[model samples]
Target: MNLHLLLADDDIDDCDFFKEAIDEIGQLTLSILNDGVELMNFLLAEPANRPNLIFLDLNMPKKSGMECMEEIKSINKLKDIPIIIYSTSLDRTVVNHLYEMGAHHYIQKPGEFSNIKKVVEKAISLFTSTNSQLRSKEQFIIYP
Candidate 1:
């Protein structure tokens, strides 16, 4: 399958690294959004071209990823699309909240390029292997 992925993050270097990893991973198309506001605009404007998955960063300018996720979940048109929290924070409290709020999965951003690939691959694998949109809380967080 040709997976269409959307990633929303503010850091230019992280976006570059993620794009590189996706290229290496292959079998997928990716869209990179610079901030939360841009991500919302892209999603809202392109209902016909919805992504298979969204990898969202928590700390972003304009609006936070948390805000985006909340908004995405509230809308009937976008709620069912799987959201993977792709963030640098390992704050357990926040992770728990995201899981409760219907985020499909959580990934604590790894420091190394190889680990980024690993975590991204793991998230995709989960999507392919399961029919359910949400995973068990025990399995919510992907460890790098």
Candidate 2:
């Protein structure tokens, strides 16, 4: 089966980059949303169409990814869907809190397009191979 993934980020360029990478990877379907509210609504509105995994950006207008994470975990129907925190900042404090909040994986957005493809490919591979199991804290931050 093709893997269905969701990427929620405000940056249009990032969304396009992610799409291109995903397209190159093949055998995967991705849906991109600009903000947290739209992401939540998309998930809630289509229970059956929800993506298998989520790539969430921490910084967003209207509602932050952190808040969205909290809400997702709180909702029974949405709680089990794996979330990978895809953000630019690698702040240790926030990373620790993300782990505490139950993010399945963490990815620091790469500067290079090649790195983005590499990082995303690895993230998807790990998620599929491990059956969406949460990794150890040391292994949480995925780099290209």
Candidate 3:
């Protein structure tokens, strides 16, 4: 199965770095969205091909990540897709709030390329593993 990733960040450098890191870390097809508006549009336009993981930056033009999270969770169809907040902020309250608001994971943007790769790998693994377990249980239940 192909793992599709949606990157929602306004920082050009960070976006480029993330793409390189993801390429080095694993095999992933990523869709780039510079802001939350585009992110939502992409999701809304292609519901069938919804990204498996979303890397969202808290700060961006057009719309913020927090606002996007609220919108995403309110929409039933988009709620299940795992959202990973990838930002530079170290605010505990913001992190906690995002978690409460249905963000699947929160990751502080790494300063180094290597760290970025490590974090990406971890995120991808967690996403795939959890989904795999869910699928396994689902299959057993349906077949048994």
Give the TM-score of each candidate: 0.97, 0.97, 0.88
lDDT string for model 2 (11-115, tens) is: 999999999999999999899999999999999998888999999999999999999999999999999999999999999999999999989889999999999
- Predicted candidate 3 versus true structure: per-residue lDDT over 8-89, tens digit per residue: 9999999999999878766789888899899889999977779988999999889999999999989989887878888988
Q: Please give, for residues 34-74, the per-residue lDDT of candidate 1 as tens digits.
A: 99999999998978778999999999999999999999999
Backbone clashes per model, in order? Answer: 0, 0, 0
- 41 in model 1: Cα distance from truth in Å? 0.8
Better of 2 and 3 by lDDT: 2
Alpha-carbon shift of residue 130 in model 3 (angstroms)? 2.2
Off by over 4 Å in 2: none
Query: What TM-score does structure 1 among the candidates reach?
Result: 0.97
TM-score: model 3 vs. ground truth: 0.88
lDDT of each: 0.92, 0.93, 0.80
Backbone collision tally, model 2: 0
lDDT: which is higher, 1 or 3?
1
